[model samples]
Target: MFLAILASNIRLVSHWSESRGVYDDICYLRQAHLFQRFGWHGLDTSLAHETDGYLAGKLRSIDFPNWNEPTRAPCHTEIADGSKWVMTPPPGTGFVLALFPEGFQVIPLYALANVMIGGFALYGLWRAREAGSLTLAALFGALSITFMINPAKASYSMAPTMVVCALAGLVTARLFVDEGRRRLMMIAAVGILLGLSASFRIANVILSAGYFLFFGLSFLIWRTRETFVAGLTLGLAFLVGLLPVFAANLVNSGHPLVSAYGGQDTAAPHLDPAVLRAYLRDTQFPLMVIACAWTALLWRFANHAGVRQLTLLVGANLALNLAFFATHPVFTPYYIIPILMLSLWTLLFAAVFTRGPVQGFDRAPPGRPRPPEMLSRV
Candidate 1:
């Protein structure tokens, strides 16, 4: 199933690359190429020359270099033909590109990384199931991937980061759910995964914050805060987990919180509050329906501890995604990461709901007939 999904994604990306005349791909490809040639710090000179050279080459190749004089901006130097001058690739993406050896095509490398990340997410789900049950685990994993693997959205520029975030979320969830004596280690591990997710996309810092709050609250509610030891332990874990993202942002953007992709004003015009609200209302209606459907499906098995955990995770992720839509000017497909995460948990809960009754039947008295199968034979 994983291989089939990956093959489909590859085919989709190939079709999009050839058929779509969009410039974002070229811009990202160029950034990847430049990163491969000159490390991150070396982007300045090469970016300028490459931008000019690409434009000049495009003009010569297409026989219309001077055709759109006003449309061409000077700052658009780092991108490929048809790309906007001011647009820049995300630093994390640039770093990924830099990891590739010279002469390797950047697009394929980036796509491959996205594919592998998806695989990692599946593996994490399987691991979660190993700690519990396969049906439940597979359900969650498939739903998450389904949300992400939609060709229309998944083939976009930010897909890699989205894949990374999903995998990180899965790993974090697995760490928390799996029973273990190494409480401190598990907390630290969750933090590290959250940090990695934030590094991929700065907005994921909000998800990390959510995780911290959820964890602290869960601990308090469970009455596990007997000692200052656990509180101090969680604090250190949070700090350790955030260090990677904070350090990367500080070193790359000179701001601990800011990402390479600037705010709404820098990227595009901000929508007015009224306009944004209307747009949100329109967009969120369908998402809310999906969320409710998922919840209803999961609610059937809410008696299980795992189902309950997944429910909370999905609820928190939905809240975060909606909160983001309320404040942010620009909305992109990548912002659906939280939604995708929630979808995974929904899948898991559905799986558990479906399987729970079956298990209960299996444990019924030997003389009693099995309950009518709710699901059709496999």
Candidate 2:
């Protein structure tokens, strides 16, 4: 499965040219060019700094209207003094591309990503040691690898976002299943992954909504110092991982927290029949249905309290993500893919998924009142 997916991704990306129909690709490449040339100072993506004509050439390649005008470029929005125009998406995607030499970035970027995700699939295979479990794992792994090409290919930022979602999914399973000193470490790791995802696509932060809900509920219901510290650690780690985006925001928008995106991208979401139809017509919707169905099935018949909690988290994440995008005015081919992928991956590795002993949160003796604080000790 790994080799097949790797070869497919390599062949697909091999034919891909730097200049394509997507204008967003050009902006991402231009951002990479800026970073490659200016180092950390490249965070300021003002058009005035385009002294080399690289951005112009990329724009002209696509025959973009008014290629010479910086403000007219797609995905580049004007901010502050009508001079500093920047791409709405954060610089992480560009920064990843900037790591490679010019004219040889995209293929390598995607190839390496295939390796990472494939390795993850293999890890899932290893985790499912039984025949029935292994068959389910194998099918899910194949679908996951195949998914890397469909909706995952709609945008360059999605490459990194997909990788982050897969890793976070695995860690999320551990977050619910594993009990002991490693729990705090896993929480921090998940937090860092969540924040790092935002650097690729600002909306990717929504990927953490489920974790936020789960952690919040656990703390509120249990009211324990452990849960409190866990939630605090997750929040702080996310801020730390989000530093690059904060730096970019500070450099581009003149505010660390304020986003550079404006116009339709930031407009308040409202129901649109056309947008709704588009989602239903796309592969994203079916993937979402599968995720929701799997969550519901697990919620109904799961044997372990840990798996139940994980399922609940998956449910919350799905509900929040779907609600946000369903009402969004603009629709994209891959907008909701990340959340769907995240939910699927988390479900695949759910701890105590098989029928067995229900050893989860230790219970208080029947004669004594059960302490609510024991809920998230895992």
Candidate 3:
């Protein structure tokens, strides 16, 4: 099942078009071009920097009416004072695109992301060779890969975000079961990976909410030096991992904390029943339902403290993320996908790597000493 999913992903990726005429795609590719042409200085994504015809040609290929006008670039937003226009997204996706030559980026990206997830799936399968565990792993690995082509393909950022979520899920499981030094290291690793994910999609920063909340509450409750250190380590490493976005913000928005997105993109959050209904009507809604059910099940009956804590973390994360997206004024097919995927992946890995799920979540007979750590929220 896992091998077939990989082959299917390869077949799908092989046919993707880099210039699929998506506005976001053009902006991301332009960002990549800037980085490739100017190196780190590409942090300045101002439309004024388009001295060459690279962006113009791309726009023309898509038949954008204002292809020749710099200020009219599709995804570029004007600063509040109207001094200049800059790309809307954080620069990480662009940086990844820049790693590959232009006109050959998107496919390679999806391909690589698929392979990375495939590797994790294979490892999970290996770790759970027993009967019931094998079935769960195989089903999960299949869902995970096929997922890449549909919703994951909705945005270039999703590829890397998916990759980061997959890794964070595994590391999250390890953080609970492992002892001593290894536990600390997993905490830091998860923090770094989650932080770096924000560079791809600014909203991903919210992904850390459940984690910090878990750590904060843990420290407040236990008041242990261990929890303190654990929280502090993750917090500091997360900040370190956010350096790229900080740099991009400082360069593009004229301030490290300001956003480059237009008002609609960064508008204040509010209750939006319409948005909630939109989610309810979309395919992502089913996944959201499934994730909530899984999290609730684990939280209700898990025996292991680490597993229970992990479940609480996921439950918290799902609630927070769902609330945020639900109340926001807009909806998209892929908007809820990251959180859904993250929650599901974390659950799947916990089932695979931990010794403490209630009954139905896992029955992988005693696998040697399970890796260890636990606190709950995204």
lDDT of each: 0.50, 0.84, 0.84
lDDT for 275 in candidate 2 is 95
lDDT tens digits by residue: candidate 1, 1-378: 665666666675554432133444444444555556656543432334454464344333344446244244222432222222333334444456556653344446545754765575466455442335564455545544444445325334455555655555544445434546765665666556555555445565566555555566776777665324444665676567666555544544556665435522343334457745564565445556666566665656555565566556556766766666556666554455455453554344334333433332335567875556622321
Please give the RMSD to the true structure for each candidate, in Å. 7.8, 6.7, 6.0
TM-score of each: 0.64, 0.90, 0.90
Per-residue lDDT for 1-378 in model 3, tens only?
777878888898999887777888898898899999999999899888888889999999988888898778787878877788888898999999888878898889889999998898888887774466677788878888888888888899999988899888888877775556688888889899989989999889989999999999999999999999999999999998899988988888888878887433556889887887788899898888888888887777665678888988988888888888877777889887888888888887777765334433433358644323221110
State model 3's lDDT.
0.84
Once superposed on the true structure, which residue ranges of model 2 sit more than 4 Å away at CA?
A: 80-83, 263-266, 351-378
How much does candidate 2 score in TM-score?
0.90
lDDT-based ranking:
2, 3, 1
